[model samples]
Target chain A: MREPAPRSYRAPSTALVPAVELRGLVKTYDEGELSVPVLRGIDLCIEPGEFVSLRGPSGSGKSTLLNILGCLDRPTAGRYVLGGTDVSALTREEQAWVRLHHIGFVFQSFHLLPDATAAENVVLPLFYAGVRRAERERRARELLERVGLAHRFDHVPSRLSGGERQRVAIARALACRPRLLLADEPTGALDSRTGASILELLLDLHRRERLTIVLVTHDPGVAEAASRRIFMRDGRIEDDARA
Target chain B: MAARVLRRHPGRTLLTVLGLAIGVGAFIAMVSFAEGARRSVVRQFETLGTNLLRVRPGSRARAEGVRPAMPLSDADVRLLRREATTLALVVPVARRTLAVTTEAGRVHRTRVDGTEPDYARIAGLRFAAGGMFDATDLGTSNRVCVLGVTVARALFGERDPLGERVRIGPALPARVVGVVAAQGRTTTGSDLDDFVLVPRTTFALFLGATEGYSSLEVRPRSAALFEAARHELTTLLRRSHGLGPAEPDDFTLWSPEDTIRAAEETSRILGALLAAIAAISLLVGGIGIMNIQLVSVSERTHEIGIRAAIGGSPAQILRQFLAEALLLALVGATAGVLLGVGSSWIVAHAMQWPPSVSWRVVALSAGFGTVVGVLFGYVPARRAARLDPIVALRRE
Candidate 1:
């Protein structure tokens, strides 16, 4: 006799809270007797699955703001709430843990380890997150497949193309399945055609995974792909526009 | 990741390891040379009778500048042979550092040791060929000689010097009766195996016109009799020389105990000096590691930044760099030890000196190398650890 369709065991998904909440964020760098303020009172909130772009010219502190938002850098004074934890006052290790668990960053240069293969690069964040080896490999392969670089899993950065490298970088950012994705000019290093393709791939993933993305870029064309854009100048917000 | 990183830089890593190996090899060789010299000296000293005691005229201070030989009259030898109870054998020996010529045109400046057949037992001479001079030869003052291996080789050259006669003084001829085995060279100043042994009476008749006897060797029955023999000999010499009770004795007696003490003091000083010289290589090796570490940090700036950015704390960065530095040093040290040992072997073979390979020296040298690495490499590793990830990633 034909058995009834097996019951699917599924976990519950609860819309808990906003992904990130920043209040009066300030970051000042000490340059050997000179104190340069990079961010002055940045107040912003990103909801779950929102694609927000930070746009500005060079020396506008957009990168600094993105760094703080990504938890890669800490503000001199601020209250940052990320994934239910107040992370601004956290120790470097705690901040790293938050970054490891709740956030992921993608740099403009596709900063994949040169000595590692594409799959290995993707699995790096999971390594720090204390994931089991077999599970990390499984996730790494799945992410590579999602980024359409499954065939190039074993290829090193040196052997990969610019677009391929960025895809690997994106795949790495998603290894921990972070709540907030921070892409700092992820397409800047690629040609226009390849950049567009990469952006499309990012948009597709954003839609499929419903992942919150905060993309930083100087290019309006790149910024246009996001649902919203925040313009910055001289370490202050100048304008904010929604698509 | 480390394995992959190393694999990627195979050439660089190999070159680094090779450089370390060279350093280690050199360290081993030099240490071996010094050790070999030490062993050679000890072996030579061992050939001199361990139970033998030497008596010479002078105080310790005076002995340092110029050594005056102990003079023994014919009456003194007769008295010691008849009256000395604690001594096994006491023979008056006069050694003059003089150049002797052979009819074959070979001239060598060597010691002419004058003693009787008892000299063999007193001086610990093991004859390789023929026989030592008996009491009859000494009584009649026969011009018979026993040549050392080196002297024999130089004078006779592959042919036996036994049954041959060679010139001692200008016209004085002595017959070579026996050839003593080459005991080897001494690290000590004295050339014990580079001399000829002749009858004591003959030496006194030929070379002892100005002095009665230059030195006297006394062999005690055992270690127990050494003190008694020394005391009795001292009193006898003082009395025979007619010294007053207030006057200092003219002769200084040197036993195995004294030789050992002197050797210990000298070895301590020599060991420190040699160790210092060897330690300098460790310093050089450490500096090499430091310089390489600094270069490595700079070379892998982007890599360090990436590691830091990817959840690696400062301590981890520090550990990674330090590990690389330590690994380099440890490899170099191992190489140095092997090199040191191998080089010592080569030196021993080339010089034909008894090589002594001290495990302590190897361990000490290796330890020093390791310390040098950590001390010097820490600065660079710290610099790498403290590298601002932002600046580092941005660094070209």
Candidate 2:
């Protein structure tokens, strides 16, 4: 079958902007009079088509930084830019728009709506984007096929296996043709064999689509799959290296 | 999608719908019965003829401690005939409970109505055998009587006694001049077939002269003349009774139209009251909907988070939940309308009354159900919309 043409608006090719940038980012939680800081003075840049991994132990603020990067939450102090646009001063709704147009997320739990069919879950982002019903269905079917779950299009999340459910989630995350894909412990809930297959799928997608990905995990084996890796300890990055 | 969500919890959805259906059904049944009652009253008046008027001796207002007003006299009746020009006929009636025995010794006590020859025409009485006493018999104070169906059946059974004499009370015997056709009941719920009729003069001679006639049944030449005849009778009666302009009239004038209107108004008020009571149950149903919607919002918090993370706006989330609630209520209301109409039909059938389902009432109930859905659905939808994506996702 012929590949489906991208339908989303593309950024100017000559702009030369990194896919993600964060300068002196900080996050704090207020509990009455006490202030608990989660991320401290983090600076990072990720170019287009780069596959980066954030490796940290529990409570090391890797998830916090990933959330900020995905536009799910804002940092207390930061100069964050994505795809040539400064998004630090964006409102909640504006951040949501940015996420809709630029970002995709894959969680460890897959997060497929339990009652929805695989195709229906894949078509949800397009539904919010106001795409017509027929086009959404067509695109959803194509995406499911690309993820090797075309036969399971009508299967609900509950009926699908964990591996199939994860594949459906990946299809859903890519529904809007987002510029950046954020995966938090994508293989955490899978058996090692399934996790390895899922990692291979991600690497295949990265090469085939020229996609930029940021993977967060504590597993060294998972981090090793990324072309570049950053190590964090105590809410601060301790090292960054490229293979 | 919204339907699928509801389908996930079939028990909750069915319970909510059943609650609403019961409420609507009750409202429909009450409205139908009340309408039937109103229609029955109108039919009753129609049978009695709308052009007829009843004159009785009592003012609309009478204090409890005051002595009862005197009965209308024969002189007052003569005076009304001479003065009231709009009246086509005046039929004086004198009623008393009397014991009558047949020659075969069958005895029964029943109401005896002493009236004029014109009373047959005014009261819409039809003869089953023989005929009413003419002017000659009434003028001579003949000892003749007409027996209603109930009286006739009790005194003679299947035997025809057109010329037989039956002893009435302890005073005198009267020949049966006619047998009245069966008239089940009057508009006032009195048994019409349970009485006998006698000439007014003969009744006066036997029962002794009272201060006045018991009542007067009057007819206008045409229905259009009823209001004029009523006004003229009222004026003449007031003037003859010597009442001042400031004093209330001592006589009450009732038209069939007035009685029918009053009955209709009363039923309308009662119907509204019953509908309001039924609506309380609907309100309870609405509360049930709200309770279940809240539970659904809480249960689907993770799903809501996922949608939000995938570009679902708060408005969209709000709309989805609201749609689910609205769909539930609308479906329930439709079922309720069917239930209500069906139950009303059943009740009407059981009672042998005509079912009266007004389309306006059905539409109003459906609209009310929809309003309830929107009102009760709001709080839960808002809660779902305001959910913080990060917290909601973390909840699981």
Best by DockQ: 2
lDDT of 1 by residue, A1-243 (tens): 111211221112235766788889888989999999988888887777889999888989998887777667888998988755678877665555556656777889988888788999998877765677899889988999999999998998999999999999888888867778888898888899999999998899789988889999888998988998899988888988889
| Residue B97 in model 2: lDDT | 89
Candidate 2: misplaced stretches above 4 Å? Answer: A1-8, A12-15, A131-137, B26-35, B57-69, B98-110, B125-132, B140-193, B201-212, B220-252, B343-356
Q: Evaluate residue B273 in candidate 2 and report its C-alpha lDDT on the 0 to 100 scale.
A: 91
lDDT tens readout by residue for model 2, B296-366: 99998998899888877777888898998898889878988999898878866765556688888888887
Model 2: per-residue Cα lDDT over A1-243, one tens digit each = 111223433653232778888899999889899989999889998988889999988989999898899888889997898877788878766676677767889999999888778999999888877788999999988999999999998998999989999999999989988889999999999999999988898999899987899999878998999999999987899999998
**lDDT score, residue A1, model 2?**
11
Worst 10 residues of 2 chain A by lDDT: A1-10
Clashing pairs in 1: B24-B336, B28-B340, B29-B340, B41-B187, B69-B214, B70-B214
Model 2, CA-based lDDT: 0.86
After TM-score superposition, what is the CA distance of residue A108 in candidate 2 from its true location, in Å? 1.0
